[model samples]
Target: MSPCCNWMWGLSRRLVLSGRCQLSARHNVDVHRSFSSVPHPPRVCVVGSGPAGFYTAQHLLKHHTEVLVDIYEKLPVPFGLVRFGVAPDHPEVKNVINTFTQTAQSERCGFFGNVTIGNDVTVEELQAAYHAVVLSYGAEDKRELGIPGEDLPGVYAARDFVGWYNGLPYNRHLNPDLSSDTAIILGQGNVALDVARILLSPIELLKKTDITQCALDALIQSHVRRVLLIGRRGPLQVAFTIKELREMLHLPGTRPRLDPNDYQGLGDITKDLPRPRKRLTELLVKSALEEPTEKDATRWSVAEREWSLRFFRSPIEILPSKDGNKAAGVRLSVTRIEGTGDNSIAVPTGQVEDVSGGLVLSSIGYKSIPISQAVPFLPKQGVIPNSMGRVKESPGLYCSGWVKRGPVGVITTTMSDGFETAQAILEDMKSGNLNCSESRPGAAAIQKLLSLKQIQPISFSDWEKIDAVETARGLEIGKPREKILDPQEMLSVVSN
Candidate 1:
């Protein structure tokens, strides 16, 4: 371990030995008695067992030596988006799950899976049971395009598509039609690129990953040859980072369909842009200007798929087929950038273009939904209303991650948000703002309530059983792990 980790471990050990911790308002355990006599320590309840929740628990446990944390997850499994939202090919990002598992294994920590906050337990119940309640449930709802024919058969949200391939239980039945020769994605973000990559990637390469067998089978039969990524802004305003773009450009048996005209004047402004934007724009310009090399030409000769970035185009409607039942193409309004830099806005030019495509995936973004009436949610912003991490007008109620801020940022960003929220809770405790006089029974009390309701919550050990079954099933098929895409099957795995 590193010196910092050693110090933290030593500090935790010392705190436990001293037994100078005070019970929170919810923790009814008598602090005056010996640590062994107190059945419950100062406890915190974190909703949602995602990265944000685990990170928050980690920080709280690290700083408050005697605190007990119970994480509640709606799914029988854990690692939320890391398991269900991240691209299957990006396995390195999933390595953080190891750290989360270590946190869950902590003596002071507990995991309660298959517990929905709104249905299984209310916010009021959790607040009454724990000293602090941290809401880390991430944004699960996808933003809609609100265009005509958006609800057509061939239209799909990028969120559902991602969940479908990643084996999320909710999207297991999303059997998207892949018989189209062309696909249109209505965003220029990394998700759009991921969707495109999955559509065009070789079946042999996909078969090696943890992608759902059903999704893999669909791709094997896919007739999609071209993918067009439509963005409402200029090339410089594309939301995708350089790494994903680079991967798409170098994908075997595929080539980028970039237009030189789109990158004509970007070279002169590249130097003045921010480092990330500068690098991304430079790469885009280079790719647009460079001619296919001999090797690339040879590869292009056999290329079976291609993807292009369409800038300054906003979808007005999803044009329906002659039968008026399924999406046949997209009608786009031409747009021009006004002003410059990040502040530039796309203004429609009153010119319309029709692009034919059999399938359309809207990758706009994600939005947070109100978990319950208790949470002070700002529906307009799709986030919880809060000052720092504390929810407005709700004492001991906190929020973190996408729900606290907005649906944006990566894992590192959520981790930092979790740490900040943990710090705020610690500060409040130190300031006596979080009264610990009233004894809160914590998880023991909550478990009793669950038992009374006949709801069997899945423990961390239980999740391990499910995990084992998944791994063994995957081994049989020569892939990573075949996920249990049904909640009932997941529960059955644990029960058996």
Candidate 2:
């Protein structure tokens, strides 16, 4: 055992003995005596090394003096979605990685990558080996469009497409066919905007990012000239924030096409909306009403690609071509909002419209899956049932991020969620609800189990080696670090 494990085990044994003595004395004298010696530190196991898990660990370490945290990740690499889900062009968003790196470097923290909880070890096993177990695995499964012809060849999910270009190992072979001249994305979130931007951006811009070489090469040969972003509600109900919208509006070589009529009633109510929404709606109105400058007219005349946001349209079905093998168009049902502002709901108008498009992508949202039988999951909501981040009816179990709440919000939201969960853990410890007096081997026991199972878990140092190699390789190609798109390749990089 490592020296740290030995110290934890020894300290735990002493605390257990001291607690037993206090209990005996209290029974004999009918008086309670406080055990002055600091209680054994809690050993926490956090599943998933995403922002949620890292932030949770950070807060736990900050609030607790001697607590030990171990984060387990299924992938050899860390920074779950930040590394694989964030758009490559938005490198600023990835700066959180530096903070996460500091958390991993904490003396009381340990990272066990390439260790899947449900497969290599079960949730019950983790709970047995630690005082508290936190499940922040996040939402990996995506919500389906559930419309007819969704399985067509040219139809894809935005999640998989984003993963493909972002070098998610599982989607490395997606190799989507971009031979179509027009593409339709059925959602109006930031992800939808990202897809539109990637499809319309100049190839030289994407080449400088960390986007996979395969996706970049494919984009260079893409025939896509038009992208249509379809949302179920009106412009006032757009889910994307202003930053993403502004980026799309300013994308070079791409003309924004919004029907001026869509902005007719929005101008009168902009002031009544909240600050964020008001600003966003104002930008949309400006873009819609602005007349083209002489320079803009010249650029539009020679523009090779364009993107438009189509409101009040919900996808009813994907229409296949005569061959019935590939997507040729989309059938949308016209929708109208019943209420104003965020409470607005889309109601179908019974009128149908057909928009011709050879390629389609559904970017609705993501869903969380139950990792193990031990976890109580709300299937309808696709989240773990929790009360303020504490797992309901399950002691020694907690959850954060999308698994605790629903899959929504930005990175800052997730950080706050993680901190809340960590606070819950600290409260439980202080209240003696989390009994840390008994010794638990923590990561040492987990390591033994993994060794017996022949699973060689990757360490943080190993991931850094892989990171160095990827960076060096990218430097040769005049781009940001190119990602290893295969698990085996990542492991090999770490090994060498």
Candidate 3:
């Protein structure tokens, strides 16, 4: 054949051998694979077992047929906030665990608990072992009040208090003194309301919940009969949801002690507010102005415990007891609103008030801490710098949940955030923005490293063993589940 004809024939043969041209030959499968370009299945590591991490993994597994996901948790157990941060009384909120359990049981997904991301394995190592690493560890620290006497004996961060009651191993020994008749909470968010309700709820009501045995015992001896929820803004600016507000109002043995003055004109303006805020404000106005129902009135008449809301009050200092050791009260500066809605600022009115209380809890907020210097974190915002969950300036690195956004919103908000991150990962994979040519060892390599470090990662079945033990122990009592409050104890259960 002529030179030109031979060149054309060679080009066509090359294309056919490269799998561009399908042939019905038996050897075509092997021939195509030898010359075909197919990337390895992407391996993703999520660095939290919380809702955010699980939801992200769930989305990845659902959308990608070949994606491998491994979840790493610092605790021996899964479900970070669901297991350790949610209020014991709100068991329904924790039902998300069922969905997470499904994800963990997926053949393509793996759960590695008792593996601290930054400690057991660095972010750099995880990136090396996986095609992508998602940092969803969430905000583990509380926002400080930055007021005097904050470190007083009787003062505590609401996160620690919640953790103490929820069986968090770190806060399990926080035996808060409950000898005082009144407790002061510095914040008007749902967490503040939860703390208030738990403090004032009849012991019989809490006994059935999964509250830590230690906390239950403390509550049994608690003399606290009054809870005061203080907010830095007016009633219209309160941050709590209507459901939480209603729960506090309808508390079995507690009565509302709201100031009528605070709700004086709220009824007139509530109609103009947003639906949620309107309902919350209307409830406040009705509870303050209108008389209670006959049954409620009778209940309140004999109720010995009460809760009150104090607005336009910013805690300036925690007053110390006579010994100057414990918090006896909170010194608040009366403030007036300067703007409207979320932009509204609490401006001091040069007026101060001292409300007496023996125990003080600050439920201001939770903030994320930088897990490693390798991750670019904005300390002021308490979040990793990210664009739609893609870590800025860091390829193959992403973040979700409170660490991607400041600690706010509920579980549904977190699910959306996790989905967004998963979408970003999928987009990167499709767009070739994420290099997936090289196969990753995923959890296999990491397990070797963990073994070398003497860190035995707890598997999902092992965690189930711990769960079964806790459940059996709780059945011995009337509670839902008596949590194993010690990491060592949890590991022991798994080991045995």
Candidate 4:
């Protein structure tokens, strides 16, 4: 890229980013990293490798004049959601990794992966060592339905299931019984639709994405059909991206059919909804009216057969199958929509009804778990609070990503949040607000944990090894990629 191009990229980067880093260009004459003076550059440590961390590092490098940055993550990989959360087949979306990688290449931009913040390091330690520490760790735990039998054998959490297939470390060990013939999904969110669509789609169709090999094979052997995704609100209030819904129409061999009556009730939530919805609403109507064209390929497609999601229903009870212990169906209490479901929300209130299924998945929401109490932690909301980006309770501490902004928004929003946090740190440093103390964590227990060589801290290099292997394996099968769902296996690959 030319100097002007680089300048444009850097300038555009600054407008949106805020959380971690200080900028110093690479020395054309191989200039050494400098420190140890009153004029020494700022040092930032970002916790988490998600989009927020990446951009936090980037904006600081490009815009700020003097600073060094480091990123820390519990996983051995970089690009948090790009690697784990995004649907793998969406390679275009995953392209964001290239930008993040470039930001991490700075000699000053360090990545400390596989290091648990509270365990391997502490919040206080970060405050003393680096000029600033930004937490960009995202939500991994799934919210419960707060209903009975939810923890039973036949039931599952959608976040856990998505992670299992997506190769997320927390829930990679999940082994779902794919032998069942029908399934139930609760929630009206986009994630809910994703779970239902993935379940109903054929394995061959799924192979195109970076779904785990184990998940794909299990899906190939899966006997499921007639997936019933239950929602507490009506279609207008459905919390899914229309583009994703449109993609569901094109899953090879599976049947997808939306109810004719469902469209009569779509609410104003979409009055001006952008992105996939603008196109999604059109495709939904066109496909229903038999008028789809090639232009629809950008975000949607007409289905050979399609799946359906029912609205205005909350799960009342999970009915086990005849043999017992296996999910058979869910009994629902219908709701009433007082007003339009989109901008102004309402739901249908009606009599109880029972829908049959062999599996049940709850997809209400995602939340970040508070790290063990060795550091500055939040009392409620399960996150460290901040003002735009600075930690409210701790000096020299900051946060970004879902943990910083709460569990919402797309990965793009994380990039913007990171930039914001980095900028705040820069302003703090300009005013000489950084604290560089040397208080060691005083615990033999902390010492033992650090000395355990068995635990490998994953870095960018380690993640590359895993990615290389998965990509190579995918070539053999003519798919996007196949993920390793075992933690031991992943660790071994990284360690080896």
Candidate 5:
């Protein structure tokens, strides 16, 4: 129902839950059903179902029993990226899902799986439905390279590619041609490493994991072995944590190569290197001293390549030779660094370059799109306009998660953001900011919009039924279950 296009888990959901109910008759006028002394709890509506939303709900439920919280998600599944964004091999990261599942199944909290405010539902309607609303929908689109040929069929945003390989339901149609002999990645973040590792992993290695059947099939037919991770900035700017970089180094068959060229202009290179880099460089130095003809220590058979991170080169154009319609290489404009480029974001522009590759991946970043009609957005920041998670322009509105902050920090940061937003809501409630005097509209109006063919929204039980089938499926594959990819299949999963 949300206007955002389907990506990882397609943002949208619908809820038809009725907790407070009453049967009306001609003379049934004893309608006041409880003691007047009991405090009328302020209701909270959480606008996302990701970790931020779930954690906030969990914290609120744990502390405040009187508050009734309703969680709204655009997706049919509840855990957002925790279910669709995590790597298949990293089952430990996936462990967080269990905690979220428990939190989602709360008595005080209601889960509205398939709904979208601003589109199927609206900010005005939400203002009428609950006392306070929290927006936690994560970033929805890929941050761009803003270079030419990005729209080429072979070129994929790292977010989309990673989503595909991870078996995220929203990206099933994305069958990236891993058949390219050489693949070039454009960033040095943790996400870039994930894409590289998965792209290089043997299909057999991925079989036991929770890779979607489609992704599994694609990996089996892949032809890529060489991955060149390109970063315009120096190695020091790489966003990957030491832990992930180390893990990449330790992948038994994955021989992570460090290009010494990245250190050429980084004065006093030994001191500039972070501990992770120093350690990685040490490993490379140790390996270089060995016989070039000598094989790796293990029999996993890692093919070696002279891949390196080239700094100060910006992509100018994507060139495709007559391998007819398929990309031949990428042409980059090399820029000269003229200052203390170390830790400086201002890149000097004046040089030019070109590098040939069989495939290209743009790992720029991700963007959070405000829903249709959810106005007052920050064009530069790509976030819904808000003050510390408080949606100021609209009353009874708030935002959290990636939608609150841009697509940058980790899940834990989102948790902190959610809690802070909830606290803000509580404070607002205490000050009598939650006045539902002139009722804007009810959930029935939202349903009326649906009946008028505005858009289809998914429901909570619909998600539960989906969860059941997917869990059973995961048991069948010896990995965690995955939701059905197509919208029809997902709807059918519950109906049949």
Candidate 6:
């Protein structure tokens, strides 16, 4: 028997021992020949082309000998966040596209782009067509600050700002104003640091990046010289990782403006913190307290731009200019921590301060919204309630990644999450929990449905054609690739 078949036999025995599955005479015969006796292989469809979707599909295809995986994406391209969300300078992170490409090239795997889930087809239809349907269409929405004057002209969500520079078609025309001398970012996460770095990075440094042409043009004309990253919690509770913090500390042509008061006694407690936290805190203290090297001292003496970290501050409103149209500053409430460690709470101190700035970007977090009414979702938590990747009360349907958990963790977390979901499906097949007795049409049925709706799905090869043109365009300008900034243009490229 194949390794998969062997695993199924072992799983059957384990299920029996656990008392969750009863191996009757009929079940014993069925489980023994489950892999070989099935009339057709299991067909699984993954919704979304992001890291979670590709990782889930990769797992299924690798583990199951006779499984077919189809990845559906709403855009004309594959590798969702890798193509749209990663920083332009961080091209190494985007290398995961090579792994995802290998998965898409598998004979048992199919890629269908430009196919929206809720609009193109319903979850019920997918459930009918595939033995298992996995929803990995990660969080696409942004959380708002909900403060007064949030709608001001100069205020933009960090999601939109990042998207604007990263070549997301929806934000191609963000055209953020950079005429101000100062900018305030209302979060201290890695994303907030990314935004601040891009704002302060020299034009020469940005010219070589894959950042959108429009964003580069805007940055060239930007007068912004200083940026402040505000957070409600202290340094210990910062959401950014050590690597991101180190990047900011070593950013070229800029100097750190950390307050000496913030580092008081931080070194004394470093020994009690976790390894990662301790290393991060030590770096923070060194940057703030220790003397700078000769080269850094020389660099800082003539630095033209600067960035600062401001703690115990929460934005209550975006202050408007004299004409009351664009943002003039931010009204921040002074805050006090009520507990110790990373889980400490920030309580308002009943005091307020206004920091002047012409631009404000909110980097709180990204959120997930319900894709279809059929899938059960918890709005307050911004996630689907699932135990072990299996949707509650919904057999043959599952979810992974941010939709499965909340928007947290890194790419490795999503990979592990996707693997767990695949394992759950495999276990179900072994125990006859997932009904694979019937052969489903999978992508064929989905294609026919799209044909009826007059929507043509873009294939992986079609995306390659688009990629070639973008690469060719980028080569002319000495960039990685000049991304097609409009969805319509992408479809046109695929059609040609």
Of candidates 6 and 4, the better by lDDT: 6
Judged by whole-model lDDT over C-alpha atoms, candidate 5 comes out at: 0.66
lDDT of 3 by residue, 1-496 (tens): 2458435433432332233122213111111122213457788999999999999999999998888888999777999998888888999999999999999988778888777777668999998989999999999989998988899999999999999999987787788989999999999998999999999888898999999899989999999999999999999999999999989989998889988988887777877888988988888898899988999999999999999988999999999999897989999999999988778999999999999999999999999999899999999999999999999999999999999998899999999999999999999999999988798878877866865555566678878999999999999998889999866667667656
TM-score of each: 0.91, 0.91, 0.92, 0.81, 0.83, 0.92
- Which regions of candidate 6 are displaced past 4 Å? 1-38
Q: Candidate 1: lDDT of 110?
A: 81
What would the per-residue lDDT of candidate 5 be over residues 1-496, giving only the tens digit for each residue? 1235533223222212221112112102211223323355556777778888887787766766566677777655678877777778887887877787777655555666556556566766676656676777788788887776767768888888877876565677887877677888887777887788887776667777877888878777877777887766655556666666666656655675555554544445545566766665444444334433344444324444323456666677777756647666787766654444245563547566667776898887888876656556786898888887787677778888787778876778777887887777767766767563343323344445544542444455557788788779888877667547765566556445
Q: Which stretches of candidate 1 lie over 4 Å from their true place?
A: 1-40
RMSD of each candidate?
Answer: 9.3, 9.6, 13.8, 10.2, 5.6, 11.4
TM-score of 4: 0.81
Alpha carbon lDDT of residue 352, candidate 5? 61
Between candidates 3 and 4, which one is better according to lDDT?
3
**Model 1: which ten-residue window has the lowest total lDDT?**
19-28
Q: Looking at candidate 1, what is the lDDT of residue 198?
A: 95
- The local distance difference test score of each candidate is 0.86, 0.86, 0.86, 0.68, 0.66, 0.86
Pairs of colliding residues, candidate 6: none
